[model samples]
Target: MRLRRALLVSCAALALAASALAQGWLDRVPPEIHGEVPARAPAGEPLTVRFSASEPVAYTLAYGGETWEAVVQNLFVLRVRPGEHALVVTATDGAGNETRVAYTVTGVGAPAAELHVTERARAGDPVSVRVTLPEPPAEVVSVRLGGEALPTFAADAVEGGAGRSVVALGAVPLSAAGTLDVEVVVRDPFGRERTLKRALEVAAEARPVQELGLTPEALGALSDENREAEAAALREAYRGAAPDPLWREPFILPTEGVNTSAFGLPRRYAVSGAVSFHQGADIAAPQGTPIVATNDGVVLLTGFYPIKGGLTVIDHGGGVSSLYFHQAVMVVTPGQRVRRGERIGEVGSTGLATGPHLHWEMRVNAVPTDPLAWVGRLLP
Candidate 1:
């Protein structure tokens, strides 16, 4: 009996020791928090705050008189009004240990914006205006050059950098010379607005004149109604542009051919003695020669028209577009995405052409600009 009693006592002692060891192994330290949050955030916009803890934890965040609870592994987002805010966060571990942190965040007003443009530009030259802001804007209201609205799109802050800026594109008309005003208006996330303005000096350059002979039948084929219809269709296409830039590299020549006519040249029809300025560069090539897209873009329009023949227009984003006219056949359809140098059509004299050729044109906000100037360089 005594031996059994001693054995029971020894078993009781071993159980107590195991219980003590288990209690000593329980976690007791609170999680250590680490990460960063923006000292200043845009008013009325969601601001992402990121942080991590040394161990698994559930946290409650308090900001702008509101509280949010979550099992956060990395980050959280909150919106604050225009003013200073005190952000407090409390973390709890599985062992019931707690860690608390506090931070001060300032909600800023409308962001300041600046306009970038060249002080001087030449007639018929493509003009690009860049607007830089401290933060991404809610919307770009308007970009105007000489009282005319331009095509605007979102662009990278710098080449090969993060996209955080807006770019406006237009051309100085052939008749425009002297000083021109540039204006830009933008809205912030909180509905706040800001405006920027600048000036550009335009210079005129003389162009050569050429005479062309066309038969009366060919000249009278297109009526005034047909011409107006085509013009209206083109205007609609130019007004709707993709919100972002599509091309990463500089534009390329659409085809390999001999240049027969230059852009912005005065052309007088010999049969009727009617005068008009050439809007595109004419390249004489053999019929069935392959034509390629100048840059990456979405096909905006492709159809046969009274004046353009088998035409294809590609929207290169940023209010920039390229046109290929007088093609024998168009291979791409509207809404199709095309890459740079991809074949889009074949060269031919389909519309009002004296010979087989391709008429290449580039427009900034529907204003004709020099296509050759964009061939090898990135426009500002």
Candidate 2:
């Protein structure tokens, strides 16, 4: 209720309310108390109660052992569990006379909910979250990422594992690297919920949303001239990662070689004097050596691009993708499904490359991850 009331004289001694009524405020027509109790809803559906009176009055609302009084009439949204609920509304007029009303509603059942997701991610990466409940199915209420609310349409549920598991899935884009926090609200048919809390350490720069207290280095870091264009392309590429994981086993090295360039290596470009972080692991391999798909996935992109020459991207689903760059030749075409260890390209020095090498990278939400970390293990 948004009741902003003004201070007024008591006028109790004058019996002002009685006199005003005697003056015939309601003589021509009876006063009206308008609005209705919302109909019953299935668990997880929203519950709202709205009311209004023809004239200004004091109103009190009672539900679940709690009573609320307001100076003006308004709407109320209740976040209670499913079942039958009674609502009591009391209104008092200027004359000190009062009226009380009651309403009841039934709510359906929903599945129990608990959050399942990774605990760490970088900015520009995707944060995948799931609500897991028992087979019967439950409705999702709300989802929040980094304290921002996402629209309800963002959630999708899949019933699997012999109807023993119901998984509600959703994700939010993370552009501010550092800490990733997520919350999910799920309700059962009877209005019960299991809340999930997730926190992940993002292997990225700290982007302070509030600038007032930012350090000079932090400010300089956020002022990236290439941020706009790069962010857009990365976001589009990351879209492929939102689906369920398609890979059946751990990732494999694209070529028979050792890592020569480790991920997260900071470097200064001798030509541009620009500083940036290396996003992938470079494996030293002879030119024309076969490069394979790390896991099962559909080739999302192939062919040349700036920085990453002979580029090929495979979306492995589960918000994860693998990138092979600096290849001598790209044999895979866009949109082709490939299997693990399938040769998709040949190793080469391409796109700002210094020598013949395979620059292999893994991304989750388009955020660069440790390629080796996924070599033989399913992602958490």
TM-score of each: 0.66, 0.55
For 34-101, candidate 2 gives per-residue lDDT tens digits of 65776466645566777888766677888756678754657777665477777788776665556677
Model 1 CA RMSD to the hidden true structure, in angstroms: 10.2
Best by lDDT: 1
lDDT of each: 0.82, 0.65
How well is each residue in 126-201 modelled by candidate 1, as lDDT tens digits?
8888887765455678989899997676666226677566788788787787778898888877577778888788
> Which structure among the candidates has the greatest TM-score?
1
Query: In each prediction, how many residue pairs overlap at the backbone (N, C-alpha, C within less than 3 A)?
Result: 0, 14
lDDT of 1: 0.82
* TM-score for candidate 1: 0.66
